[model samples]
Target: MTETVLAEVLAELAELDDPKARAVNERHGDDHGVNLGKLRAVAKRLKTQQDLAVQLWQTDDTAARLLALLVCRPRAYDRGDLDLMLRQARAPKVHDWLVNYVVKKSPHAEELRRAWFADPDPVVASAGWALTTERVAKKAAGLDLVGLLDVIEAGMATAPDRLQWAMNHCLAQIGIEHPEHRTRAIAIGERLGVLRDYPTQPGCTSPFAPIWITEMVARQGAAVGRANASPGR
Candidate 1:
């Protein structure tokens, strides 16, 4: 049954191939040659099909791996399985999607984060930081915010590119969500000068932590104001 499902999935992907889209993806370092829109559509149809997802992932096609990230049951795999998958993730796009979509949603995310953070493998370490950034942005109730800030301040300068991006995001989330640390986060951003002068396209917010934090904080304040100004309030 898994083989049959894998065959069907591959057939669908083959039919959905787009040369133009594939070209764009290749330009952006995605050598998959498969259309992402079609992959998402396939994932929606195959949701929660863990056996098929594993089979597709074993095929090692980029689109199939992305589908695996979407459809695989997070609870079915433990840290060992995730570590193996991360080790096999050679493509940047595949590694990123696995981190965001698979690892972040897993029940063992925090456990994996602790282990992966210290991993010498850059991909594993990047995934750890990415998961931490998500937790900081969303549910930071029990996290040691000060310790986290200290780690980011100490390591972000020498971190690899992928890990550095997520670390910067974590710093911004601290400033945006934790008012007590906002001043310190901004100070760290200023000291590091990360993306401080990086050119941004028209209308896009800068990724520089200070600017990112300022915009997020203002946006949050405006949201609160709107909620308070509402008639029901």
Candidate 2:
């Protein structure tokens, strides 16, 4: 089944220059065109197939490689194929690809979460941001909230001003996602220190607000925690 999917993808890749193919590709390429129309067609045909994913994984073009990464769902992941994609995904856009798809979709949440912590690229770092935002909010029992927190800790420990700014943005995102656990974020603010904390910098786009601003988060979470601690209310 995988091989058959691969064959079809290869066939498409081979005929990329054919007028019929060009027309189809053009239709897909136009930003003004509806993506659903194209996506539906692709999905229906590729529902059970997996080869189109493989060819794109193997493609030499950085854009094509990133596109393939974006197209494949996290659930469809073949570890070997993902390993290859990560290895070949040297371009910045590829990291962005992982950020938007794997992190945001987060189908295989845990493995991809680990990747965000380990990957050094800014784009991959953004995945860490997404995970922090998505998981910390729910406070899922099995998800490694502590491990994700460690990424922020490491970022604060080593970050220079520029990198610190970006890392802080990620921390802020975590806070927004988990307003229920603002105390967990206090460490992030404390570690980040006085430099442009997110709380004080009202206009700043960075998500990592100063710990003080987390007052709202703290208040909300505290109320919930207190309520939960109480008997039946």
Candidate 3:
């Protein structure tokens, strides 16, 4: 039954593949060509199935694994399971979706975060920073926000593209959420000049920390203004 199910799912994924879609994904370092929207739709239809998810993940097909991430019971995997999955998922999209969709919701997130944070591998370390970025925007208690900024300032400019982007995200989140750290965050961004010249589509915000910080803060302030101006009171 498991073999049959896996075969069926793989067939369905193959049916969804598009040459143009693959071209676009290839540019981003993801080899699979299945449209993401269709993949999500399939997952929605299949719903959560831990056994099936594990089988899909074992196949190591990028599209299958992405679907597995969507259908899996996130908290079911133990620490070691997630660790293996992260290491095996080297494709950019696979790596990103695994981290964002599955690992982030797993019970071992904090444990894995600490382990991955200082891993010699920049790709692994980027996952750690991604976890930290979530904390910066959400919980943030017990975090040495200053220390995070210090590390980012020291390394982000020299970090690999993926790791640098993750670090930049954390920096922007800290500036946007914490009033006290805003100045240093902006200053660090300005000094390093990382992502400073990154091209952005018109009407989209640049990922450069200083500009990102300013824009996000302004948006939040504007939100507050509109909320206060509402007639609820």
Best by lDDT: 3
- lDDT (Cα atoms) of all candidates against the true structure: 0.85, 0.54, 0.94
Better of 1 and 2 by lDDT: 1
TM-score of 3: 0.98
The C-alpha TM-scores of every prediction are 0.91, 0.49, 0.98
Superposed by TM-score, candidate 3 places the C-alpha of residue 120 at a distance from the truth, in angstroms, of: 0.5
Each candidate: RMSD to true structure?
A: 1.9, 8.6, 0.8
- Candidate 2 backbone collisions, by pair: 5-51, 6-51, 172-207, 172-208, 198-209, 198-210, 199-209, 199-210
Model 1 bad stretches (over 4 Å): none
Ranking by lDDT: 3, 1, 2
Q: What is the Cα-based lDDT of residue 29 in candidate 3?
A: 95
Q: How many clashes show up per model?
A: 0, 8, 0
Higher-TM-score candidate among 2 and 3?
3
Candidate 3 lDDT, tens digit per residue, 45-148?
99998999999998878999999999999999999999988889899888998899988998899999999999999999999999999989899999999999
Model 3: worst 10 consecutive residues (lDDT sum): 224-233
lDDT of 2: 0.54
lDDT per residue for candidate 1 within 1-233, as digits (tens), equals 77887898888887777888889888776766776776788788777888987898899888778888888887788888888998888778888888878888778889988888778877678888878888888888888899999999999988887788878888998998889999999999999998898789998889999999999889889999999999977
Could you give me the TM-score of model 1 versus the true structure? 0.91
